[model samples]
Target: MRNHKYLFLFTIFFFLLGFMNIHFSLFGIVCMTLPIILVLKDRKKTWCQNYCPRASLYTTCGKSKKWSSHKTPRFFIKGNMKWIMLAYFGISLTIILMSTLGVARGVKLPMEYLRFLIVIPLPFDMPQLFDIMNIAPWLTHLSYRFYSMMMTTTFLGLILAMVYKPRTWCTICPIATVSDVILKK
Candidate 1:
């Protein structure tokens, strides 16, 4: 079950679709929700071992046997970093929801600057891309917020994969940590 070659390939396929302007939200939604559902159903970190795309990617590309044989720092895996990251995720989600609702009500917030920071290096502005696809403006706004949140988490995963254990980020991942807690109960 640990070999996730198919999941790794699927992740690459999705990235290509994303580059072609597809939304690909269903995959993200599934990734976010399935771990919790599995934990509730079977009380295990099944997703991390057999299903997470990022974990698959790390296993395939992170050269963990060669580059990360050292024990991960205790703090990186079992310290305050996880809580801090979870707090950031919670706050970011709250702000994104509030900002999206504000857009629906024709209210403007200074969220654009923050959104811009989040979207850097992407070839197109998210709302405008959605506009081109004839999607509802409110949906566009929500999509941008979701993308921002995903990118933030991905960046953290990349950093963890580079410096610590290939799957170290999984230890502090909000979804994984939450699932672990729920499964323990």
Candidate 2:
């Protein structure tokens, strides 16, 4: 734990880079997919336990009792929270794919702003850090969607960390839930 807890900083770095260059948000794809792939290969939650940057962040914070330490309510833990997250994730993925496909088909879908929870668009738009004139519009759109999803989860995790034990979000994280569901069979 001591050796690897700092890996959490990658989560912070990811957001920083993503905000600077939305293309960096593509890295979220690795994060979102790697856990499930690792779990499938190892038949375990190896990503959550030893390598998840978000989990490392939680662990780092847990070293101090600075957080509320309240146990997650059974309402969230007994089953529903994970499912809700999974549904949210699934719906977001659907929107991302469908919209990107629409753009690719030459539909004039305006680039959407930073959406929280896949619905709440923030007032600010992502700035173009570098010239993207050569980049395909659909690719840009895809990056935006990926960034939003990653940000949404990070915000949720931070809120959960503050309100309960730092690792509370992990208990119901979509990746963790998906792993659980797959492993059950």
Q: Write the per-residue lDDT of candidate 1 for residues 9-51, one digit (tens) a residue.
A: 7666654544444355435677788888888877787887788
Best by TM-score: 2
Clash statistics: count for each candidate: 0, 0
Clashing residue pairs found in predicted model 2: none
> What's the TM for model 2?
0.91
Residue 8 of model 1: what lDDT? 70
The residue-level lDDT of candidate 1 at 68 comes to: 48
Cα TM-score per model:
0.80, 0.91
lDDT of 2 at 178: 91
Q: Over the full model, what C-alpha lDDT does candidate 2 score relative to the true structure?
A: 0.82
CA deviation > 4 Å runs, candidate 1: 1-3, 64-71, 109-134
